[model samples]
Target: MSDTLEILLTNDDGIDSVGIRAIHDALVEHANANVTVVAPASDQSACGRSISHGGEIGLVDHELGYAVEGTPADCVVAGLAELGPDPDLVVAGCNRGANLGEYVLGRSGTISAAVEAAFFDVPAIATSMYVPVDETPLREIDLSTDDFREARRVTTYLAEYALDAGVFDHAAYLNVNVPTPGKRPAPIEITRPSKRYEMDAEATDGSVTLHDRVWESMDPETIPDPDGTDRRAVAEGRISISPLTAPHSTNHHETLTELAETYHDRVATADD
Candidate 1:
């Protein structure tokens, strides 16, 4: 158990979402830590950091959390700045679905919540479970403390030790996805985010449709990936942990130096 660390937990799912509850309970039980849950009042999946600057924000009180009327990013900004004193860590998700691959990095509200935390210079982790479709929403999955037993186990282990172990030395955040614990519990491994994507769009009558079909298009029997990629390992019943850094890095590049010099030369010509 962690010794009384302060943790701020939110999720892409609403503040009242079952996934968050499982996470909060797990942290409390496993880490024996002080935790505060401040999350959006409604489902905010895929809604990056968008928040209305002057909109009215309502609070829906819960036994374990406060549901704010805003996006996942709004919840984190609110959680870190005004909810409780700055948390030592920020944890997002235990999401009902997986967030993996390169294209998913930008589109996932679950991971976005953790990205928001990174900008604040806090260590953060995002977690999710991959559910196959041809199914109803996850609330119909008969959720319970038992449902997230392994997700919580992996999350608890990382949350307890990742920081002191410097596991995040090269990454801004960790993205973890646990396989459904059924016949067997899988091995855990460190892996990289897979860079694969496929989106199928269709237009019918006067409406267009967008579908994410990479999971469907995959041939698990053939399994093209060379191992150690998040997608392949998880497909093979392994819990995958990927450490990622915030995008949009700025550094000195010599090619850009010439471009800057050209811009200065243009300014001189204009002045002349």
Candidate 2:
């Protein structure tokens, strides 16, 4: 509506996280956008679209923006409905870890925030960086704003130009994944979410342990994701952008329709 871009920025990580701060600064300083942050006060990673239903969500004013005591989805709702200005765009993340597969679409709070915006008919972008798992566990790795430099650049560029480019005309949101900044700048790739699903569950000693084995093989050579997939692009040191729709797409199933038509008749015949 306004000539100046108004952006609602949020993330799965807390308001004080480096990734969120990096993108927030980039949007204001580089993109010259009016950015309002309504992010979780604490890390809410992997909390997909969960909201505080029929409950008052607490909000605290921060120097950057408002810190919400709820999920990423709550942040978007609060921002759009009450907390901040009506945004031209909603941005989530510069997330610490990559959300690259179709399976992750329903689990990532970072992407969920963007999806929440889409439900409100607002264009959105969700950005994340690929953190490689090495000898040290991912939890032990300390990342700074420098780690998100490339993500910040790409996100800012998209925020500034994508609207004019009509990128969101078809897509509800863009899921963007970037590799950790390299000596050379990573190339951009338009990709689809990888369909690879490698979840494993082990049951022992009356306890079940669930594991997503995909993280163990992020090497370009060993990565099982095919070309043109988000995971492959990020694994190969490239930025991956997947344009996505919010609502679940459906196809007419003639077989299911026929089955439904016969359901009552079949049950009566069986009873007889």
Candidate 3:
């Protein structure tokens, strides 16, 4: 716990992206916390912690600071282990889109970066903005960069209050999403990741089309998610913050263990 916040900033969107720049700017406004950005030189969305094998990682001098040539997780790994002092907190986004629901999380590089940090016993946050379809350009979304004021609002507030207040003590990391303000009736709710998405993938003549059905694209009137779920809260135009823990083991049943032991002993004795 340094006296001041030392932050390691990163994103799935490449270092030159607008979203990362906006976030870095907002964090720099804090006179106390120092922000150092070490992120992928190129966009690695949905790559999900996949590291390059012996690839070149060099310093990229940006207007903000140095950017690395690797995945989002690579940036965090390099920053903590090599580049800067271990950050007080790792913030992974202000991503181009919401990373709500279990399915989305498993596929999102932004969330994966935060998850990687949690493995090191460091608290992290993954933030995103919801942009309705057709409103954004295919080029930029392809480039994977955007900054909504509401997304920044939630991220700034969380960054300021979350650490010192010990909110992260309970959760390994937070996954936050700001609903597009265009959606009517905004309300913020503490929520859980919804695990409701089905994949419809098909292969055509030398091509593949993977359709991702996100409920955020649907009208709030049609979503079947219960209250307090991350998807539901965002659909309602609220900033959704989900407290998440990475990779945990469930307790094994004593009776089952005992039975397994007994069976194993009998089999061993019989073999002897």
Candidate 4:
């Protein structure tokens, strides 16, 4: 790694979003990084790792970087394979909302971008801020670059030093979630993704409405996540950094082995 970093910066939010711009400026101005922004042209949040397979992915030159007509994952694939220089690191987001649970790991476009980079043997970081639900609806809440001050501070620190610190030696990528800044700055904490799952569906008039009940319980007092979990850390006004691997890990099972061994015998017996 050189003193100056070559970074591929992207996000699930559109390139015009404040969060992406905040992070992009932070890395370049603070981390002394040369950043190439290859982000979605439109909001692609929660699109996960879905790519435009066998389809054309359009790219437009923007003042900041390239605006990709695809998902967050596609931005990374394009950045690493074609659009940008071979980056030392790939960063996805300063996303609008928090992605803090195990269930969200496979569903968040912000995190999926980082996961895509890991497959290319590059270190990556996925960042998001936990927005508190208030009387103002989430969609109506307007956030500015000021809202991302803490996120930018933390992300820039890591980007500047984490590589030389060997933070990525064991972890394929990092999932970082920052709490909305308060009167005092939030402290950073290492954490694991929470396992709590609370999804419900209501069916009426031949339509089903899916609800993720977890958001309602994110209050510090009501959150059921343990102290060391990402959701809990964020709810308690701390930055949560969860080191994670990209690949799906499988455990060896004797029962599955035995089942495989009996497969031909069972088929023959059924035929007989």
Candidate 5:
């Protein structure tokens, strides 16, 4: 929250990715923050928290930043543990695609980067842009840094205020998604990830094909997202910021507790 902030910037996309470049530039120009960019050498999209561990990780100078030949999570670990200039905030993404819904929390490399930072006890922000899809696959959309204006804007704004405002006091990190660029800037919304699941698989010939039926729900008219969900906010042309915690929660289950208590008795009876 100082006039000059130390920030670690990263993404699921490769170091050459336009999204990360925009983020780096935005932070430097707008937030006046000292930023270090460490990201994958090649696209590591959807590669959750998987790390390279003992495997050798190569780092090379990239036009945008330092490129790590590893997963997004690996980049974070390296940046925090070995990389110089520890950060006050870790910012990930300006991702080409939206990372929405509770289901995506585990699969999205964008969110995974933030989760890794939180484990290191650093407050982080994960920002992504919603790329609309119709009959064609979302990947077909050719995105450039130019496509990430809104995402960069929102990210810079949050970088400036979120820390001083104590946003991280309640949340470990934030999962932010902005609707595609428009004539005017979209409003921000506080939201939670939607609990929506729709995956279908079929065997075609000798191969099994998996289809994500959730894309069908992206249509604003058909989406089942409720008022305060991230999905709903993005669908309605608003920026969605889902405050999230990194650690998994443990809740007491009566059935599991009973099973544990009875297990010894059952084992003794069986032995007898």
Candidate 6:
């Protein structure tokens, strides 16, 4: 990678999202980075690494960049394989909502975009901002650029440093969560995903409501994760960076190995 980074940017929250725009602006102004954005034309949150598989996908040209009528992962695939130049790095998000914890790793479209890039042997980073749920009626939350300043700064800093410092040599990608900007810039913490999970389901009148209790435990005082976990750090109003690998890992199991080796014998016995 050259000193001037070639970055392919994407996000779950469409190409027009404020968060993605903030990140694009920051990278251009602060790092002098060359960026090409190809993102979902519409919100694809929680879509994970889903692609359009043989279906037709449309790409629309926009002021910020290309808008892909597909999932976040599809944007990465299109950006890397068809739309733009080969990128030195893939940066996804500055997502509207935080994506933390181990359980969300495979389900979050923001992180899944980064994971998709990693599979192509490219270094990637995924970022998000935590938005607290309000009791008020659901309305379009208008976020000013200030709301994304911290995430932009962190994304710029990481994009420059991680490429220069060879941090990708150790990990496939990074999952970053930043708290809402406060009176001062928050501290950065290197963390792991929290293992805690909370879910509740209820059925009434033949319909069902599923609730994710993880949000309820997001308060710093109530979070169950240890201090060094992403959930804990985010709850404590810190920027959390979790280095992660894209592949699912497996360990050798003696019993499984034995079962495989004796498969023929078992089959013969069954026949008898």
lDDT score of model 2?
Answer: 0.93
**What tens-digit string does per-residue lDDT give for candidate 5 at 19-95?**
99989999999998999888999999989888997668899987766899999999999999988488999999978
lDDT for each residue of candidate 3 in 113-210, tens digit (9 for 90 to 100): 99889888889989887766666653356432233566666677778888889998899999998887543435567899987786789999999998
Q: What's model 3's lDDT at 155?
A: 74
Check candidate 4 and list the clashing pairs: none
Model 2 poorest 10 in a row by lDDT: 132-141
Better of 3 and 5 by lDDT: 5
**Model 3 — which ten-residue stretch has the worst lDDT?**
138-147
Give per-model TM-scores: 0.89, 0.97, 0.86, 0.97, 0.96, 0.96
Candidate 6 residue-wise lDDT, 25-114, digit = tens:
999999879999999999998998888988789988989889999999899989999888889899999898889999899899999999
lDDT of 1 at 126: 96
lDDT of 1 by residue, 125-192 (tens): 99998776555654566666677777888888888988888877778899998877665567898889
Whole-model lDDT per candidate: 0.83, 0.93, 0.79, 0.93, 0.90, 0.90
* Residue 166 in candidate 3, Cα distance off native in Å: 1.3
Please list the Cα RMSD from the true structure of every candidate, rounded to 1 decimal place: 2.8, 1.2, 3.3, 1.0, 1.4, 1.4
TM-score-better candidate, 4 vs 5: 4
| Model number with the top TM-score | 4
The regions of model 5 sitting more than 4 angstroms off are none
TM-score of 6: 0.96
> How well is each residue in 164-251 modelled by candidate 4, as lDDT tens digits?
9999998999999999887676899999999999999999998999998899867788778988999999998899999999787899
Cα lDDT of model 2 by residue, 146-232, tens digit: 889999989999998999999999999999999989877789999999999999999999899999998988889988789999999
After best superposition, candidate 4 residue 178: deviation in angstroms?
Answer: 0.4
Better-scoring candidate (TM-score), 2 or 6: 2
Query: Candidate 1 vs candidate 2: which has greater TM-score?
Result: 2
